[model samples]
Target: MAGPPRPAQPRPVWFEAAADGTIQLFTPSDSVKLRRPRRDPRASIVVAAPPGERERRVSVTGQTTVEAEGARDLAERLAARYWDLDERADDLAAMVADELIRIVRHPERVRRFAF
Candidate 1:
């Protein structure tokens, strides 16, 4: 038997590859994306390479778990990676002070394609 289809809500996110080959993502504690996974750990992520002569893409399918304790650290790392956090350390710290969630995906399979 099948139930009602789940709603699709897509949003851009930054990700980092962990040494263990898992993907790490950070989101606000209030985000639905963070909440929904608790009910269903299954998840997938797709990333497309910058536009060029050929289009390249990678997809990962796996299960995710919320790591609350690591969220702050990961959020700081992400902020530093994407922005000059050191220049405005106070602001960055204040921003991350709000509840954050760390979502770690254990990759079950990975697929890459180029066109």
Candidate 2:
């Protein structure tokens, strides 16, 4: 017999690119589902950096690879480089291990604004 459905686990948030080039972020929970959809190369991934008190937005865009795992690791790396936050790949992955539905995206759409 089949086993009971497993409960959803916490996962790191990630943005994805659609065929139309629109961006979408997977919630920490909704990532439990797999085989949902892979990002299209034609599109781009936009990562919005937290704004400072002065008021400004930082965005980065670069080519990305598609993968079904290793999302948290990616997040950690991004955080370190962009946010100057030191994070471990293992711990990052572990934090979202329960909802380890990984997908890779490379940012190609980028923009910034300062006030």
Candidate 3:
């Protein structure tokens, strides 16, 4: 017999490489912090928009290094990459700076699926 399926959750958060080689993650309260997993020091990323029914997604898993930095800066860089806009970069960056932190992970393992 097979078990029930698992629930969907956010996975493979984005993290860019800072001047230094480190990874980062944001807190629910809009605070930047390190998402260092005691068991799994590595990290993974799934860079695809949330899909609806009958949709598909592409993702990759790899090793990661957590970088320690102020939240504000990290958010902006992520926004710029995701949005690809230059104007109001600072403002937009500031908005999510606290929302996300940076993570430096390598593409060691990759997996894709359709739903």
Candidate 4:
């Protein structure tokens, strides 16, 4: 459950890159993502360059921690960052209220690759 994601089952999740350089995302409290990482604190997140851009990507391998605080706020911020929340306001509020865990990864190794 550490380093680059399992290529056979890579999950595409929305994430926020914190100013402190940690990668974060919210998941249901009982999600496998939370379960696996709890049993094994090693994890990695790979982000590819945006569409219409040159081929490049970044991979971060790190120790992960699940936080109980700030999940709602983080969710709101991430939703706005990645979507036009104006249309999904209700959906956002509803999902934010669900039991959620914040997965924060503190990077031990960060690699950048251009292909």
Taken over the whole model, the C-alpha lDDT of each candidate is 0.85, 0.47, 0.54, 0.86
* Over 4 Å off, model 3: 1-35, 52-54, 69-74, 81-101
Best-matching candidate per TM-score: 4
* Model 1 bad stretches (over 4 Å): 5-7, 86-91
- Model 1, 4-100: lDDT tens digits are 7687556789789999999999888898787678977888889988766578899999999998878888878878888886688987878787998
TM-score of 3: 0.44
Q: TM-score of each candidate?
A: 0.85, 0.36, 0.44, 0.87
Q: Who is ahead in lDDT, 1 or 3?
A: 1
For residue 23, model 2's alpha carbon misses the true position, in angstroms, by 12
- State in Å the error of residue 100, model 4: 1.1
For candidate 4, lDDT tens digit of each residue in 62-93? 89999999888888888998779889999898
- Candidate 1 vs 4: which has more TM-score: 4
* Sequence-dependent TM-score of model 4: 0.87
Specify the poorest-scoring 10-residue window by lDDT in model 1: 1-10
Model 4 alpha-carbon miss at residue 64, Å: 0.4
Question: Which is the winner by TM-score between candidate 2 and candidate 4?
Answer: 4
